[model samples]
Target: MKVGFATQDLKRVDAHFGWAKNIAVYEVTPEGHSFVEAFVFAGDLQEDGNEDKLQPKLDAIKDCAILYVAAIGGSGAARVVAQNIHPMKVNQPEEISGLLDKLQDVLKGSPPPWLRKVMGKGQERKFEFEEEV
Candidate 1:
């Protein structure tokens, strides 16, 4: 799956989803992860409710399964969720590489239900008790 990180310096997930100067994308798997691409934005990106700026950012991560950010607005999060992209918020700046490693570890282990859903394996299972005789 693809993952995106919102960062000002492209080193950490330290920027708001709306104001991030750069969005670094990576291809992640249980084996490992690697950088895929990055999207750069300029001009005013402050929190002023300018929804237009979000389009390009959305386009950048259209194929991403997850996004990491320091913060995100309600509308921004809604838009991301509408696109089937999961947004993760961090309380403070976190290294993108560290996050990737952790995600890889999770992929190696038993990921949570939501994560499995994001990984495109969310099919509902019917247990024996639920099967109609």
Candidate 2:
């Protein structure tokens, strides 16, 4: 399954879903995982009144089974869930590599029901970042 990490520095998952400028995606499996791509935020930073700001981010990561972030606004989380994308909240910034390692271990073993569901849906087609709006 493909997992997306909200990160500002590429080395760690330290950004909120609404504020992350870059998101790292990876194809994860029990045996291993590899970096798939990074979705760069194209929308404006000042999102004060633009409720639609989450659209682009959603479009970019539509293929991901889940998203890891430091935080997510209630509405944004709703939108993600509405799209069938699972949102995971991390209490603190975490190293992307370490996180992936732990996830791989889970993948190697028997994953919980929700995770199994996400893995099952991971085969969906992905939208090209540049081609899509």
Candidate 3:
């Protein structure tokens, strides 16, 4: 599946979803992953609360299954979700390659339901949570 990452230095996932000047896309599978390409944001990176700044990004990652962002506005997340792309917010800045490896580990192991969904396990998963009867 394709994964999109928001990064500023082209190495770490430290860029905000709406202000990411450089977005790196990677193709990840159980075998491993590879760099696809970088999507440059030509618009103003300082602009905030504007969907126009994020449109190109959404378009660029239309085929992506997951998007890793340092931060995302509610509207931006909604847009991504509408496009069937799962959005993940990174708590801290980390190396993109390292994060990818972690995802690989999850893929190789017994991934949780959410991870499975992100990996495109199946459409419309049935969620079951234990509750007080």
Candidate 4:
């Protein structure tokens, strides 16, 4: 199966999926439960309010079975669902290893409603960041 993680710096899971400059996709083999191969999408930063920014990520979703993201907007979420790819909302953790561990279960199937609701809201992280500091 294939999985995609929305990330920034191509390493850490970023706070927001839309704000991620890149996405790392992995091909996981059921045999050993390991990532057999990987790919990266590196390109222009998504422009705020620019709907076109999601095209690449949407395109990437076509090849992956599941997508793990920090946060995603309503339209993006809808697009992902329409593409038949399961979307899993993952909180940005301090370590990627820990985050991956937590996601292991979620990757098994569809995400719960709470997560769906959050993604449907399309709330941008910039607002949350402003509230934090």
The number of the candidate with the highest lDDT is 1
Question: Which whole-number lDDT from 0 to 100 does residue 24 have in model 3?
Answer: 96
**Between prediction 2 and prediction 4, which has the larger TM-score?**
2
Candidate 3 ranges beyond 4 A from true positions: 121-133
| Predicted structure 2: lDDT | 0.87
lDDT values of the candidates? 0.93, 0.87, 0.87, 0.63
Question: For each candidate, what TM-score against the reference?
Answer: 0.90, 0.86, 0.86, 0.62
Q: What is the number of backbone collisions in each predicted candidate, taken in the order shown?
A: 0, 0, 0, 0
What does candidate 3 score on TM? 0.86
User: Per-residue lDDT for 119 in model 4?
Assistant: 33
Tens-digit lDDT string for candidate 1 (1-133) = 9999999999999999999999999999999999999899998999578999999999999999999999999999999999889999999999999999999999999999999888872335555666678
RMSD after CA superposition, every candidate: 3.3, 9.4, 5.4, 13.5
User: What's model 4's lDDT at 41?
Assistant: 48
lDDT of 2 by residue, 26-110 (tens): 9889999899999887657447557777888888789888899999889889988887889999999999999999999999999
| Model 4 Cα lDDT, one tens digit per residue, 86-113 | 7878654334545555555554557577
Predicted candidate 3 versus true structure: per-residue lDDT over 1-133, tens digit per residue:
8999998888999988888888899989877999999988776777776667878889999888899999988999999999988898889998998989998888888988876766772356777999999
Q: Of 1 and 4, which scores higher on lDDT?
A: 1
The local distance difference test score of model 4 is 0.63
Q: Could you tell me the lDDT of residue 68 within candidate 3?
A: 94
Q: Could you tell which candidate, 3 or 4, scores higher by TM-score?
A: 3
Better of 2 and 3 by TM-score: 2
Error of 3 at 96 (Å): 0.4
